[model samples]
Target: MAPVVTGVIDAHVHLWNRATDPQPWIDPTTMAAIDRDFTPGDLERMLDSAGVDAAVVVQASNSAAETRRLLAHPSPRIAGVVGWTDLTADVAAQLDGLDPASRRRLVGIRHLVHIDPDPDWLARPDVGRALDQLGARDLGFDLVVRWWQLPLAATVVAAHPGVRFVVDHLGGIAESDDEAGWEAGWEAGLRELACRPNTFAKISGLAGLVNGGDGARLRRVVDVALDAFGPERLMYGSDWPLAELGAGAVAWRRAVDELVGELSPAERQSIMSGAASVLYGLGG
Candidate 1:
């Protein structure tokens, strides 16, 4: 049975068209899994099954046109989109091209920060300057850094308090025993980052990271995040298409429910929907 309507809004999902642009993942084995198109129709079907009201479509590629295409699609369920624009680009001109109506759905900006986790990536003077420009535009910055990269990410994030910084996947802790290499640093950095009012954390995507959709390990990580970010700064997201790697959207929904089973009703609501609406400026 579909989960009951808890008034949740899935805060992160990706919709792709394989015909238009093939994702950069070129491994013959893994690429085949997510190489197809997922449109508004696919999203609606999944939302109906999960009983979610709306969602924020985050960018999978650093393509402004892709964001424009998704925004043009007519759907009330698509309350917002975290489109990608090269942070290093001429952001003002690039942002001006996005129609106001379409851009209204754009709540945040994200570039694949983890692609190269040079500890100095976030701390560079040039990168810090770009992030400052993004803050001037009043858009949130999605921090997609890896686990070992959290310490520097915290330093990078600290440089821009004017913008909201969302730490995706609880700092992208790999859902495996190998996570130990950076576990302590990740946890410590999370705690420090949480101390920043501008920072928020997305509690999403554990099933895809760990083997066999490990629910127990995910719960433990969730506990740590909950402690750091608290209910107000935390939000739920279904990393969709990527989530399909571990299990389908349905499996992710189940895992999230089980992981948060012990939370208070209000806490659950905040994590599931409330925080996302407020932070992303999505309508209730």
Candidate 2:
């Protein structure tokens, strides 16, 4: 096979020590398969072999300590980390609780909004107040919301003029859904969200969205995101560990490459590496 694209960064991944940590979400089908820990060494080899240079290690749990553990791994492979925190918690106090170095590695904060589908959560007094504090701190927020919840997501973005928001996994589009029309509403919402200067999007998780390796489904999703967020605000992520639910590192890279097939070389590099480098403060 031709050499896989070099210097590509799998912007999102997770490196966990299952012995010390428990992730309740790993697939039951592969529980026995992935029950063992996956270390930085495991991830580095995947990056090296898959032609990926760096990655942003996102939190698999709502633990600040998880961010610290990944940061202490002593590997240059993890360029940044998108960690979890109770955004509704005492914002200043929670930020202070983070280890100094871990906070430095943080590119953004994320809460599992996918599990909490309530539209009012976006405008809830405490949640909205906490989000304002995030904007004051100049940190990004990764919106992990479902497709049906995207309209509320747009509302949240519209309300927060200063906070930078990243919509993950194309709003978690179901791969079985027809591309053209089924995507229109969410696409419209993304386009509306993009009009806000602070909102960005990630072109990741294509593998998990499909049931049987439907590349066409992935293509439609990518096209809409690229059209909405443009190359500048868009970044690529592997959603590893989670990505293992669908495919391995090598296969994931191929799918990402194929999705961006029509882009110019520089555009591909931005989605693959450049945008993430700037966002996460990971200098090349």
Candidate 3:
């Protein structure tokens, strides 16, 4: 496979040292592909093989401890860290307690709002206050919500104009036999969030969203996202080990590169690296 997108800053990735890290989300009985230890060393080969020079390590668990571990990783491949923190608690104290070194590495914060039973979990006053704290630190925030939560998420985004919000997985895109109506609704909600200048979209996680590995539908989703968010506000991400569950790591990048190749080379490169770099403050 030819590597068209060079030095791609994979905007979303998760790395866990299973021997020491507690991955409450992984079930060994089911997810055999990624149930074992996956360290920075393991990811290095994949990045090297796929022509990805740098990446942002996103949180898998809700523990700040896991975020600390990722920050401490010695891989130069990790350009920034979107680690986790308890958004409901005193976010300022948590930011203050972080060592100078980890603080510099902390580019953003995220909570697994996708699994939360409450649809309006992000609408709480306490949660909004904590997210505002992130802006005070000049940090971005990753919104891990499903399509069902888009309306609530838009409300939160509207409330905080300072925080840069990165929306993941084409806003939780999923495939169905009759996706025409769903796609229209999804695009409408996505447009509402995209209407906010602070919000950007990560064009990753398509593998988990589609069935039968249809490239055409994946390309269509990319096109829709590009139309909604535009290339400047969109970024590429593999979702890594999680991607191995659906599209193998290499295939995901290749497929995304194929769909995005339609854009000018400068535009493709911008989505692959420049957008993520500026969004995460990963300076040249």
lDDT of each: 0.78, 0.74, 0.82
Q: How does candidate 3 score on lDDT?
A: 0.82
Window of ten residues with lowest summed lDDT in model 2? 1-10
Clashing pairs in 1: none
Model 1 score (lDDT): 0.78
* Winner by lDDT: 3
Alpha-carbon TM-score of each model against the true structure: 0.90, 0.87, 0.92
Q: Which stretches of candidate 2 lie over 4 Å from their true place?
A: 1-7, 30-33, 117-119, 178-182, 208-211
Q: Who is ahead in TM-score, 1 or 3?
A: 3
Q: After superposition on all CA atoms, what RMSD does each candidate show versus the true structure? A: 3.9, 4.6, 3.9
Candidate 3 lDDT, tens digit per residue, 1-284? 00122377988888887666777678777777888878898788878777788888898888888888888887878888898888888888887887776578888988889987766789989999988888878789998877767888899999999999999988886457464567666777788999999999998877554435676777777888899888999998989878877866787787778888889988898899878876787763
Give the per-residue lDDT digits (tens) of candidate 1, residues 1-284: 01122367898888988677467674558756666788989898888887788788888777778878877778777878888876666777888888876677778888877884454666777667778887876678888887877878787777788878899888888656765656677788899899899999998766564437465667778889999999889998888867777766767777778777788999888888877876776642
